[model samples]
Target: MYLMSKGLWGAIAGDETTSEAKEQQAHAAIVLNLSDSQLMHVIDSATAREAWGRLARFHHSHDMANRLWLKEKFASFKYAASSMSGHVMELEDLVMKMKRANCGPSEEDVCAVLLRSLPASFESLVQAFRMSVASFSFSDLVSKLIAEEVRQNEAARVEDATALYAGKRKGKQYPKKQQVRRAKGPSGTCYNCGKVGHYARDCRSGRGPREQQHDQSNVAFHASEGFASDSWVMDSGASAHMCKDRDAFEEYEEVHHARSISSAKSNVKLNVIGHGTVKLRVWTGHAWIDARLENTLHVQDLSKNLFSLTAAAARGMTVEITRNECVVKRGGTPVATGRKQGFLLYLNADYGTECHMAEDDTELWHRRLGHVSYGTLNATVKDGRIKGATMKTNVACDVCATSKQVRKSFKTSEEDAETRESSRSDVVVCSDVLGPITPASKSGFSYAVTFILMKSRYVTVYPLRKKSDVASAFERFYQDVKTTSGTKIKVLRSDNGGEYRNETMNSFCKAKFIKQEFTVPYNPEQNGMAERMNRTLVEMTRCMLKESGLDKSYWCEALMTAADIRNILPNASNKNSSPHEMVFKKVPRIDHMRVFGAQCYAHVAKEKRKKLDDSGVRCFFLGYEKDQKAYRLLNADDGSIVISRSVTFAEHSVTKASKSRDTQVFDVIEEDESVEASLTDDEDIPAPVTEEELRTPPLRAQNSSHHGPSV
Candidate 1:
């Protein structure tokens, strides 16, 4: 066997150690004998020195070669270990520094250095090392190294386990805990007998010792000879003694036939505990009864089943009784009193009669009182006051009729016509131009024109520079009126003038299919609507300008303001409905109207004002608030037109005109110069003198003089 083992050992050592001494040593260590081929195979397949060392460690012992090799490798291994240990300590110090700096090592830095140097199987090596040094301090650098190595090994193991598990087919299995029922013992001992063997339900002591002291025996007592069920039984919860059986009740009725006790004819159904509901006829009356069951009847024990006596039964009693401690005195005496108990009674009395009771008496009082309809209450009072009087019938409230009368209807012809008229979208309109007064104080415009609508009497006025620009003025008028009225012009009427006869006016009329209605030369009456509007606007403007003590230059603003007011005011021709209302189908809301040229105050928005500045500026109220956003004002100090939301008006100060009249005078001179310049430029373009013009200058009596010489 020794020889065979030596041969096996020799084979396991491999061909690299072919020396005789080595072979002999290898052979000595082996045990079992083997054939040459088997020996050779063992030698060829022998493990490396590191593997042998690992095997030695796994077995908790070192073989001869492993011990010798370990001794030799110890120095190099210790060096590597010391170097790695130093690196670990440095890494820990760096980590502390990083923590102090509130930062950690970058993932790339960790991966490239620490992870790259670690062995492929380093995780397993680390786990084995950690198991060997399990009691080491985790705060030490060596422990951290081991822990990191173990974590890597665990991650590798998890990956392998996950892959293995994922590759397997799923199985159906119930959880172990759910497959069985756990057993438990009972909770408490019986209190009645002080025994743990049985529950309270099986105990024979009836009740605990403390509860038996107050028990009372049931007893029967006779109420009266004529009362139903003469032997009255005492129940702890029972109110006054009651018997509801039909035969027994009939017997009581016969006995009390002469006592004036009337039984109710109602087939009233009442709930009886344990017996369900039973139909009963109730009898109620005042009577004296003897009490014999006092020991069983405790005064404090009142059942929820009996509360107040029913209304019918209460009324039937000589004096009605209730569950609450109440006594209804009609002529000043006690009627009834008792604590609530099982079975309330309904007394028999006049069907509609009411027993006065306080609202706080019982739930029944609240319920019955709540249902007592005011309409049915036959009591007389003034203004909800109640006296001790009965009413035969209800009275009608005349005050209600006077207070709730319907409003009178207001019907008008104008409203009817407005409802019947075609919408603004379906109308054709007409208008004409009218004025040129002094230049406006604001725009330097000297003219104002009237635009009149023929279909609806809607008129608008515009200020202009010159009547010579009449075509442009007409275009402006058409655009403004059409935009406001949402209607197109079908006909236009005007007098013949070089301005009106121009190609611009003719082309516009042709394009729009507007029939140009003209008056006879020098006649203005044909365009009566335009003419009348113009006259009215001019007069209103003149009056306003004169009253304001301003130059005629303000005629434009005055004309516009007057036109707006006139269009909104009720006219006699339109049946007191304004032209604006007739055209727009509704009265324009004029609640925001202010006096023209009146001083007014306007609010300033935070965004538009400085923090320290006042809220509004002083200005004149030129017209109504327009377009719902801004007020148009003439800045009296600058003669400048401004639209703003920040202004304060001193209505009385409107008389003060700005010191800017020089601007208006300059504007007039400039306009005259422009007209003269245009005329001069036309003259500069020379034309040849006509022959008829030269011959006409030489006209003489030459023919008559020649005839006299021949004779």
Candidate 2:
């Protein structure tokens, strides 16, 4: 890559033409990717490659002191049986880093080190490696090791599946032929059968009708449970913007111990740390729109950041959610939008990160929380509790005012009551289409569909190119769920979309002996199961995107990740069990879960990368790969997504902050090992400026040398 006009490259190019402007942009990007120390010396380099070489030299020299330190760690490392590949990957990355510094071992030397790192269980492989020619390179050894690792992982997964299904089968009831009933007796009374004498009193039957059926009603409307991570939840149930990050406030006024939130059938006492203005960053149609949220309640130790619909409605703003983004409109004009992440909706990229806070007043309580009845206020005052102010409200699930009595939105009666019993998995399923997400996903999908099982509230999502693909998606999903659960789907419910009402879908369902139920043409509530599922997946997908610091183009992957996490979480209707447990009959192992967007190193086999290239490639964690016991990671270098069981994650507690794009700064959130590589931004790196340049006169012309550093 020889540079043309090399002298003018590193220093900013002339604004002579559009091509020159692009070259200047490229030059700036190359510089911005440098770290603070590297930026100091490379600032005067005459070409991008020159600056890069200088940076490499600088980092190499600095990395020297720790060379022996890394060597010792490599020798002493022992691969853990639980995650041997991950351990080996970390060691390999360390070796690569040391090699870049010109202070690393030779191929044979590294091969010996890798063998030593193996556990006793790999002693057979160790012997095999030892007996081979000593000329064998580290890359070849790594390939063999990785092959063994993948095989072992597949065997373990198969064992787990076998054990789970076998145990499940031993307990599940399968239908058998019914016995013939004896002649009817007086009033059809029978001792064995509870029915009016359809059978004789002494009638022999394997089962008795009088025995009460297993009561599954107890699983309904259950209480709350803890989440694996404290991601924000955009809840229809929450009354106001409830936040845990005190740094997000523009103003604050702490109230003494207040416990206003009630969920999961238990009361959590999160004292109102303060109330103030918080700015949330949203995507408005195309660009970012920073929206200032007022009257947000900051609570200490809160599990999630909640954005209330009631608050948005109060401010004359409307929130409309879609598959790719959440749109907030004012009088039908879309003003703000936020991409979805796992189970949360957010605008600012760093929504939960710590930010600054100022002080405020207690009067904002009555000023904000909602529709306070004076009678209830008096009761609260006498009871030594806080009371909110009265306001015209539409919040049926307001968080702040739940302690007080509220007016009911609707009365429960015959018409509104749910009559069907969804007591078995896949007995009743609902599905709906979500989008035409403008720029399609990596899979070239512009639309998506959601299928929810009514009994367990378990969701399965499929990305689609168009609504027409609905039949194919359903056929695939039907086979997967049926094979996994060993149960046939009884019925499917959806809106009257042509995709669902068409002959293809109708004929397929009819052939399977499955019923198809349709909600009225314009009534979405009638198909609420799938409607709510669509919302949940979108909300959760936005949270994952916001958390990962990735763009919206990855929404399909984010949605899949969101859906997976959601299934493992407790169902709102049944707090005691998660959808995964209900459907799969086993608790999911969530202990191995890492943050969605954490920095990691994925082991690259010799077959994948060049021999001299790094043994591991830098990646950002996307989510777990479906149907495979591996992680789904995006190659940060090329934007290609890959799945691998051999990967190492660098975990750290990242600080969250909210800022407008113009002033936003990247917080190098990673363990020291990966910080340098993670700091490089592909765009928007500010050029280094000196005090001399700052002091120069603005009127200086193109020839003034005093202006400094200009090409």
Candidate 3:
């Protein structure tokens, strides 16, 4: 449209008679295609002429058009372009003419002309038009403008509807003026004067001088006398009353007595409450009041005003309210109630008043009672002769005698033995053999012997089947003890048992370079180490067996378990250092230990588990594994034992009978000699027991059968 308009004007201004000019006019006519009447009106209007000049200037200089002219022209062209209704079409037209005269149009110049022609209502439309023209093709520019106009109208309509519902506007109209309401003031009767219209401070009928004076005087009087010389001043908000110090209470007693006589008396009783080693009941004439007693008391009004009255009162008074209550009483009457507030007490008083009151009360009370004075008295003796001399003796009591008792001395032993430090490596191993195939253990093997290291005091035990298996027992003992002590057996100390003197044992020790240290035959105490270890192992085994309430068959388990415990437990012979520490250089953690024969819960591993399992297996903790981080467990249901690292112990799960018993026994023994023989043979060593060896008879026949036969 702009091109057609500009082209027609250009043709008219140039050669009107030429065919090229006529052709341009014809092209403009076709593009314009306005009706004759509309064209005539457009041409006759002076506004159109002014609009053309404005458009021309906007295209050349890019200045703004008059706002009034833009508004009127937009109103006239509302139907032609809704978006351009509030815009000055003449300014835009002039820009188009200049652009057509120059060849290509400048977008910035066109935007400036359009913006200048835009009225208030078309501001958004003009912005939309500029953006649309810049971003879209020329053909889409007009369509986008029209669409933006429709969107703007719809948005305005929705806004008006929302405002109407919110009671902010009626329809799409806005009011020229708005009114606001003012806030109201508070209303009520005044507390000071009981006036309905005013507040307390503004009350006209003021308080009287006499009433005010009385209040002031009352405050002053209370400030001066409310807290007695001995009385503790406390906040009124406190819930319970407390008299902690005896001195505070004593001072209070003196002042209270004086006040009791001076006031409108009705026998007011004050019971001080407190708790300590002993309960105290202080009865003074005052009423029971509610207050709280703090553990610490601060007397801001006095220097060194705090005292441990609870302890003093406990030592000084004796009275009862209720067993749980810390109450003071006069005569047999109850005066105070509640839990005893025991501890220190604090009070505020003048130094002079405290001393004078305490002294006067002390003198008066003594005179009244006619009791002997503590220090001195002013009483004069008749004829300068003191009569009825009073004597106080400081005699020692039962506690003093008991505490000061001394024990009689005894002579020291004359025997002196060599003393020297020795490691396990330097020790001659020794042990006593004592056990029998008693009652046949669950594994069908029952025998136990104590094995001790002379240097390190480390010990072990081996269970056997028969005395004849002594050779085999020695092999088993060597395997266990050697691995534990990590040392070669250089010497073997033992009683002169036939087992130790056997050719096979002597030959084996000689071959191994071990010096067999044997005591004289029938004189066992010479091998005191083996003898003592034997006694110790027997004692431990007895304890274990008694504690477990099981038959002597499990004696092997008890022996092994006891040996392990003893090895770890501190021994006096080793300067209270356990064998484990002497060897391992570290204190073993005993936290995971469980009592022998204690019930234990063993977790079922995936390999051991089957589908539909409901519960875990129950077992007894035998002992710890020496080689691995595992525990030796004995399943009671099955005599077979298994080593596991995962198990929960129920230390308190001992049965009634087991608890009553004093001993417990849980033993483990290698049941098959053939297996042991095979192992020893595989190591290129002689079978621990040869068939011929098994045929040996007992050296000493079970004579009296004392504790069965000592192995």
Winner by lDDT: 2
- Runs in model 3 deviating more than 4 A are 1-416, 419-425, 472-486, 636-642, 656-711
lDDT of each: 0.36, 0.50, 0.38
Candidate 1 backbone clash number:
20
Better of 1 and 3 by TM-score: 3
Tens digits of per-residue lDDT for model 3 on 1-711? 333444444443344444665554444343233322223323432332333444345445322444334334533432222122112223345334444444324655444444554334455666666566346442233333323433333333322111100112222232222221111123556544555776433545554221221100000001111122333322111111232233232222212211100000111122222221211222232442322233332111121122222211223323332222334333545443333111111132222211111323333222211111222212211111122223222333232233222232222123312211232343477655665545665555555555566666665555556655566656655654556546677877776767678988887777778788776655554454554454445445555455445556655565555555455444445544546666656554433444666667565654567765623577776665544456777776675686765465544334322334422233223222111110111111000101111222111011110010000
TM-score of 2: 0.37
Query: What TM-score do all the candidates reach, one by one?
Result: 0.32, 0.37, 0.34
CA lDDT for candidate 3: 0.38
True-structure RMSD, every candidate: 46.0, 34.7, 41.3
